[model samples]
Target: MRQGLTWFNIASLLLGFLFLYLPIALLIIYSFNESRLVTVWAGFSTKWYAEMLQNQGLLNAGWVTLKVAFTSSCFATVLGTMAGLIMSRFGSFHGRTLFSGMIYAPLVMPEVITGLSLLLMFVAVALDRGFVTVTLAHITFSMCYVAVVVQSRLAGFDRSIEEAAMDLGCPPGRTFFQITLPIIAPAVVAGWLLSFTLSLDDLVIASFTTGPGATTLPMKIYSQVRLGVTPEINAVCTILVGLVATGVLTASLITRRQEMRREAEERQAIANS
Candidate 1:
């Protein structure tokens, strides 16, 4: 027999959700307000969104953010996968402790320190601070996140499948690509999305590394916030939230459908056997 939720449980859950999402809900609702002030809801209107469209600076910043997020996430995923594979499959090697420490240190390090260190490193290397520097910085930090995700997925992987592939005359490279990659593809994709979100949401690091004409969306938002809160910012934030929600929903649907199909195929194979 299934027990229904008690009043206490329901109340607690409702309170938790409200505490987490109330600010976001208010911001989204106010984005449609006709009044210039974000706190006072005059009436529902899309004027702020329209005005936001005409803002060239915001558009440029968004474009730069998208580019950097995509590039950095892609590079981070590849490098992180390699790092995870090395640590998981290779057992031990020279400098293993140092490599592992470097990979995980960013997780606990302060963003201010990370940003300042990267800035100093860039200056010492004489690398011009701009989109390239920002992208590199994002990849450097985001790769650690990806590595952690991939490593967790790899920890539970079955080695018997790989051995079977090799027994069937498959080379090491072929076994990895055909068997291991498919098994870990979900984790890799998850890592990429995490890296992308981190790159897009980062402010302090991007601010430190960004030069003129290379502002990201987070940096742009921060600059506007210093002036004051406006409905325009709320509208922009709402749009961004919607985009992220849509992307996540679409990815989840795709993954679910693929998993169902894979399950059906496996069931059919079992029946045939």
Candidate 2:
């Protein structure tokens, strides 16, 4: 019975992974096809990737996407961290429930509704639908995700260290910067990465908010896809997969290293004491 259950679990895990990654794997494989037709694989070639580089529209869109993702993610991280700190550290402040609800409302909100509402708000304010609008819209939604991540991390955090710092005459701001921030740095970074990914992957909100000269990679790819999927599109998608995979891997390695270093420091401190 035990042996049968082990085999069943292994098969289920393999199937789960196959279901999740098979399309991506196929897309990557087709990216190198010499044929312009994405589905009909011809001889393998790197021409699509080279051609992609030369496509000025794609290049410009990619640059815009990167800029938006980076900018929105940074702002989201800062604002989200502050919100998370307040929600987790402060107990029952005035309108805490309302504040928390507002922070998380975006998470459950429909993307179409959010996009429509933002578009109306921008129009109401006479804001142009362009790069700034898209970035602001992204920050508005992405910050909620960041807040959730940071708040989860802070939920079980040890407050004794912070209390001790305050007892020793450290100002609240100083204690946060010198002690609490370091301990929660991983969570903060994770939140930033999450926000970055969300902003990068977003399409509907970006489309509604963006205007001339600010087309993101997703919008570009989507437009191209509507015309037809080609090997070049496959190549672009493969590149995105590679970039995102590299980022996640790098972050994981850095987080693991930090964890190991923190563990070592804790052991050393205990030994010294």
Which candidate gets the maximum TM-score versus the true structure? 2
Q: Which RMSD values do the candidates have, in order?
A: 3.3, 2.7
Candidate 1 per-residue C-alpha lDDT over 126-186 given as tens digits, one digit per residue, 9 for 90 to 100:
9999999999999999999889878876886768889999999999999999999998888
* Stretches > 4 Å off in candidate 2: 1-12, 249-273
Question: What lDDT score is found at residue 138 in candidate 2?
Answer: 97
Residue-level lDDT of model 2, residues 82-122, one tens digit each, is 99999998999999999999998999999999999999999
lDDT of 2: 0.89
TM-score versus the correct structure, for each prediction = 0.86, 0.89
Pairs of colliding residues, candidate 1: none
Q: Enumerate residue pairs that collide in model 2.
A: none
lDDT per model, in order? Answer: 0.88, 0.89
